[model samples]
Target chain A: MTQEVEMKEAQAPPSNSFSSASTPSTLQHLKEIASLIETGAYAKEVRRIVRAVRLTIMLRRKLKAATALAFINFALVQGSEAHAKLSAYLPKEDEHDMDVDTASSASQGFAKHALPEIEIYCYLLVLIFLIDQKRYDEAKACSSASIARLKNINRRTVDVLASRLYFYYSYSHELTNSLDEIRGNLLALHRMATLRRDELGQETLLNLLLRNYLHYNLYDQAEKLRSKAPRFEAHSNQQFCRYLFYLGKIRTIQLEYTDAKESLLQAARKAPVAARGFRIQCNKWAVIVRLLLGEIPERTVFMQKGMQKALTPYFELTNAVRIGDLELFKTVAEKFSSTFSSDRTNNLIVRLRHNVIRTGLRNISISYSRISLSDVAKKLRLDSSNPVADAESIVAKAIRDGAIDATIDHASRWMLSKETGDIYSTNEPQIAFHSRIAFCLNMHNEAVKALRFPPNSHKEKESAEKRRERQQQEQELAKHIAEDDDDDF
Target chain B: MDPRLVEVTQIFGRFKASLLRNDFVTSSNLLSQLKVLLTKFPSLPPSFQRTANAYEELQIAREIYEHAVLLSVKTEDQDAFERDFFQLKPFYADLKGLIPLSPQEYPILGLNLLRLLVQNRIAEFHTELELLSSDALENPCIKHAVELEQSFMEGAYNRVLSARQTVPHETYVYFMDLLAKTVRDEIAGCSEKAYDYLSIADAKTVLMFSSDQDLSNYVTEEHPEWEIKNGCVFFQKAKDSQPCKEIPSLHLINQTLSYARELERIV
Candidate 1:
């Protein structure tokens, strides 16, 4: 209960009051966090430590060079190696305005050996500072040193801060374009985190490794590792969202468009609303995968708030696909070729060419019950020397893939589309209804499984004899009070 | 200093010398012997045991397997290429810092890629391509195979057929020839459906066949249904194909109605 009180002290009003105050009060809050960590470590309650780390996130944006210098001077012993290194990382002139309290705190709490949690926290602070400062090379060096220090410390209290450190470690290496340099190191760290049963560390490192692999278009390796990694309930929403995004990308590249669409849509839905950029990426991919699967996504997807401008090219691309215009698709692809390549989705767009042909063939077969091969080729706008032949094969493949119901007449060079039947007369609706029911049942089962009961509530029940005894005691007290009143009279 | 390394090193040297002399039989024997000796090296993959000279052992073993892959190419033995390429993959994937980059890496990797394309194993081709670094994807050898794959998927047979003339390395010729056959077959499958008949000379040009004999031989072996009459290829039309079965609408409607009733009752 005391630790819970400490947790509230760090969590409840800091972020809300953060905007209600100025820089001095923010620095004051930063100083209070040091004491919180000290008490947390002394009491061996990790939740307090976790709360201290959470508070740093709220203060992260308001941090300046002088605040970092003063915080470092107060957190570590004055003139220690870490203090000197951290102070040197800040600008030299920012220390001119340190308040009296920070200076007194620096003099007061200069312990010879800071706790491991505090050490990792300082590393997190400096790393976030350097990365925000755009000093990636320095950030890389700092993160490497942090990771080395992290490996020697095995305290469970340090796990939360260590996970944050691992995140910045991979982020800095990625910024330096030297992720290849630390692939083996990251793997070793992941193994260590697994052995320690640090679920958050495992989740963060697994996502980082996937991002690393997918950075170089290594879908095969990413899939192999993802399948073999230990599965557990997610400990962090943000990391799980990232994991889903990478999985969607791998599935997209591997031609599993249905599964890819599900993952990408889930990722977009589960992402925090503030993460507009990530949501836009997920939506863009979901649209393309749906297009490839022969399903045009809803219009509101492209018109999503804050996503309209970035998704305009995809909207135009989707329009071209919807109409089954090969020429328009070609132009749209050419116009946004740079954007697609930058997104590393040009390979997926290249695959979309077949989908374009299939869409064109489906439209043509629907409108024309009987058409010559050359006419079909002309309608599709196939640009090859043998357009008729290419059109024939495109139609053949589409037919074989169930894109259309058409038969080719080789002797007369005509495609004879079969008469369209009413879809409602088929078992399609039955199957669709059955699937919906199954989906509802599955969701109910999942919700039931997710329902959590309060711990030991069943033990709160009272025995009948205890209730009767309590009632008798109440009557006796009432009678004694009445007898005392009569005696006073 | 390890005797197993010394023995593997000597056999690898002999393999290279025999390969250069074009004595394939002797080089083949040397390659097999070198592979067996490499298994004894503690530093190789699936073991990765560190020795005093682990780097040297790994480098030599990699070279021997690289040569063996190219040898399979030279010998036009597809099975051996697959086996040797798999054995050599760990060296490229595992030993990045141990040894300097091999000059033969891109060409051989590209060759394996082209082989996959020829076999129409597109998924594996992509998987292999993914393992390469971004810089490697820019190599002309890899770029050539990638463009060929793109063209193949786009059904641009003319470009695919023309790509054979611009082979980046000599070893690519064999796979390019096989890929050309695949492209021609793809085109053949399409043309027979599109045209009622084409002149013999037109079919020759369309299939990229050099002579009437090759055209007739292909038609006879691959599509016996296609008849050559009046100096033109007359493809078999839809006469022999099975008619489409009609959907039983009444039965389907009954099933759907029953399902709706059951759903209504449950609700």
Candidate 2:
């Protein structure tokens, strides 16, 4: 019985294969070997097939089998001491319907199943750790080592290996502003996702690729992928929710507000109740949809709720249109500062808020038409960290890019270049963006023209008061003229 | 005393008495009073200011009132009510400014604004109902008390379809189908529940914008060749375009009402 049990242990597969065709001849030979042992004879045919098939098997699986054999041999060499660590590592009996977090944890050590790949995975793992630590240089170095190690392996083409390479490359360029590397990595991911035959793998890869495109503002590429994404019905509820959310965001960015609202509502309705993080993400998307739809007051309410739920700081900073409450925005900014502990994210949030507040102040110019550009700038400067200093930095950057002429045109609508005349007349966002820059530079007249309608002094109540004052001055001048006529008489 | 508050109080007194008697003059006078209250520094009550939901509802109500005031063309004593409702006009302007005017909203806004005024009327009816219930139905100032009672019941049914939690599918199918049939057949011989059938058709215009699918076929086919536009799903005339074939009669309404129950079972 002990011998039979030992023989059974020797034949167990090192890795699971859902496809029976991938099962090795070693297993078939082991079956014959067991029968031969029962009959007390060597099976020559079984031995031949095993040796021939073993030669064609990849080196990674060979190393895995060899390591496993060495571990089994160690039991004989040291009385189970070598097997002890291996035995304890017997994977926790995996639950089939494991949630995402638990599933990631369960698969954390899956690379160990392939001994050769373990070395490559270890390097990538260390790089991920370095990236998490914000040591981008160290992470890039580790990523280089990982890619080099992968080139050395020269194994059968694995899609996971390709994805990891691009993933690492993408993150390495994130801090360096290396657009070429970033675009290359994203394109690679896009290709890999498209070429992948595995349904689940394709879906997940597409999800990642879509998000990367969105982050880089490559809307055209993202839209092409979005059009091809399968309708979300019949997917796992969690995956369905994510698919709907992405679809909704894509539509929202394209200004298809009504369609986006329907998709987002479906996502919020169906998102997993247990995952607070995902629920908050759905809420954040809703807030974003509302913002795009120009429901400013409602957006403000939703953003505050989103902030309380710790959804994201982006919503808090982006929604500067409704400055009915500033303390709320400030509180959210402070929360983001502590949560991220990254000065980049903190500074980005602060800059976004300052721009929003400035836009709000500019709106006052659009509405009542009394506030001067300098007065608004002074208020913004006092409220903000340093308004003038920031504006100068932007101007310097523009000058360096040789875009000062373009910047000046943005300030004054009347001074629009002949080339820009047609484009500036129709595109509101473009005009606003340039006008915003001009306003920041204190080109008041240019900013006013960029506005929806330049403030008509004749139309305003204050303009009426000005006209009355002018009439009084005119009457005084007439009286003076009459007095001069009497003196002549 | 704040002049606006005193005005509101005086309007409240007259409005309360009229509302008790189901008096239009009283409510119309109260509109002026309500207008004064609305025009005060804070539009809604102080308590509403503290809560987001209340603030939103007040804003919506304020919008409806203002839209009705804009659409008010009749020259009457109730013009004061229109004037009072005018105080709420800024909310509508704000809405118009914020929400880019889609072609669809032009008709729906007018209708919804009308519905908003009707809702205020319903509120006054409720107050009258409460006052009358304190003793008996023969309360002074309530002429055509039976008709008023019937209208109030119809209004209650309206609430079910209008509320947020309302099953939109059911409102579209069963309630609407029943209404169309009752109005088309002029089924005065049927049960009192049949009276609810006609109002459901009138309510469709309000719901038309809410649904993503084109529902015009349901109306056009039923009336055969009728094109209903301007948030008017019910037609007064046959369509100028080619007439669609008449819609098949079915128990679709009953099926719709059961859809929620079916979903509950499956889920």
Candidate 3:
């Protein structure tokens, strides 16, 4: 049984929370049970071990609970093959009632009547097990049962457990694309977390809400929530990484490339090595943001360990942008069209076409002092013939964007590169710098405004009341001091 | 008949009448009502005894959304246009077999293609294109966008600019004008580089402005660096104000002497 648990742990995703250490006694009992089953021990002995495992869980040995639940499931499978047939023969409603009846009867044998806490615990354990098994429908049903039972319980000790169940419930809705259901449940969970001052719960629920908003392309609502969400440092590295990544994505859409780049870089650097998929996604957006800011991404960005295969398309895209090859860019875009669409980076990539043209025109200007518009067209591979007008427009755009220093003569259809002295002395660079600083300052002010305080809590209210009393006492003391001074006069 | 279907039909009729009269305010209100009504009706209306009724319902919904998109365009409400277009998109995407689209579908789809191009959403442009039947590509409306995109991608700005004249639909004229403005701006930038000044007439012709006043207004608004004086548009400031760079005549003479010595040695 220990070996089986270890194998399962190894096979599970790195994000799974089951890697924490379990107690030695639990492992020993599990090992003994596995050996007993392997040696064809009697059903009574197996049932005794299962009861022992359940006792350990009831004793609050939380670490080994998953193993205990798995052992129980295994015992049921081995001791009563008829149980599966019974469940299969019954309707779903009847099956659920029968399971509950058996559980109640089993509990009566252990304790006079089943405790609601124990029932809730049993349901929660089953829900987690089903979720781990990728049985979403069964997990959904199990979570609903656990949540319903949780309402009758005192819930003070079980708030975290209830939050977990709600998370799984909403996750099931997400998997099914029941957007409205997910939103409603998440909102309820958010309200509960806010009222309880559960910082971690709030962060988790807010992240889920952000994911929903982004999935629906509702950035405005996501921004509103970001501003209103309480400011607490995320307790988990994974959650922090996700928070920064979403912030970066929102900033990118708003055209705040500098801040977006900073956030994306931080997210990429802080992402766990095991979370290769998340890191790759961060790097993809980072690459695009960098390109948008007219900076070519370093080649090493694409060569990051474990991300090489995933970053290949973006690398080709960066290469096309760097070389300013319109034809190559088009080919790359068409080749990886599906990948871009799936990643939802297609819009950003499309914007890169203008960048490519700018770079191409800039290079052309540097190489030639004066060239006919027709020749320019040929060099840019714009058209086969009579491309003078097209070439003029492209050159015009290049000049306007400050990508090139050149002028067009209409009658002669010639483009002349500006003298080096004329290009550098313009006030454009200063204006550009000022605008960038203004943008940074604006973002800083926005961030300051967005910072949220914790919702009013009993402790905060008590502190406030104490402060008010202290202020009043100080005023009274000052009044007495003034009276004494008057007497002295 | 389903009461919801009857209401939808009634609202759609009002929407059509408002659109025909160019009453955007009334039309927009009716469209919102129709949207709400349609949502209450099942995607596959259950009251319909035949599958054909469901298909017809889908067709009516599609037409309503398409009209909403057109109304949004006519009013120049881009946000509404985008929302309406997305609502109409599923009908085009999913009901291909159940109900064939009307002939107007291609023109509107093509107009959307142009809109995407103008907005620089090339990836979505391709995605939408991929959803169409191969024969749809041959439609004049779709072909116009495909050719324009090809030209734009190939650096054939002239072709893209000229494409404005041959746009397949009236709705397309808006995006075409936007593209023309983009092209004209590009040309204006190049003109600043190649000449110190151009005659006002020549500037007007190169920038594709129809009249002198338009050219003058464009220069005043967009190109503050440009100076119009004495029938010429000067790209740079007046000659006296221009910064002069000192020529290195001694360096040039020395280089020429060195080259002359090398030639004498070779002879």
Best by TM-score: 1
Which residue pairs does candidate 1 place in steric collision?
Answer: none
TM-score of candidate 2 versus the correct structure, residues matched by position:
0.28
lDDT of 3 at A430: 43
Q: How many clashes does each candidate structure show, in the order listed?
A: 0, 5, 9
Task: For each candidate, give its TM-score against the true structure.
Answer: 0.77, 0.28, 0.62
lDDT-based ranking: 1, 3, 2
- Two-chain DockQ for model 1: 0.22
Report the lDDT tens digits of candidate 2 across residue range A1-489.
012123223323443433333323433333232232222212323223222222212222322222223222221222333233232322232332222233234334222223333333334334443443356766665565555444444322233333444455555655554433445444544554545442333455465566566554455566787787653334234445666777776665554767877888788777544343455555655655554444553544444432464544545544543552345567766767664332122322332343344344334334432333334335444233444322322222222232322111112111111122343334454446646654544564455567785457554556678789657756755554433222111
Question: In terms of DockQ, which candidate is strongest?
Answer: 1
Q: Candidate 3: lDDT of A328?
A: 94
For candidate 2, the docking band is incorrect
- Candidate 1 lands at a TM-score of 0.77
Which candidate's lDDT is highest?
1
DockQ for every model, please: 0.22, 0.00, 0.17
Q: Compute the lDDT of residue B235 as modeled in candidate 3.
A: 83
Q: Clashing pairs in model 3?
A: A390-B158, A396-B186, A396-B190, A397-B186, A406-B193, A407-B193, A407-B194, A408-B190, A408-B194
Kindly report, for each predicted structure in the order presented, the TM-score of its chain A compared with the true chain A.
Answer: 0.86, 0.35, 0.63
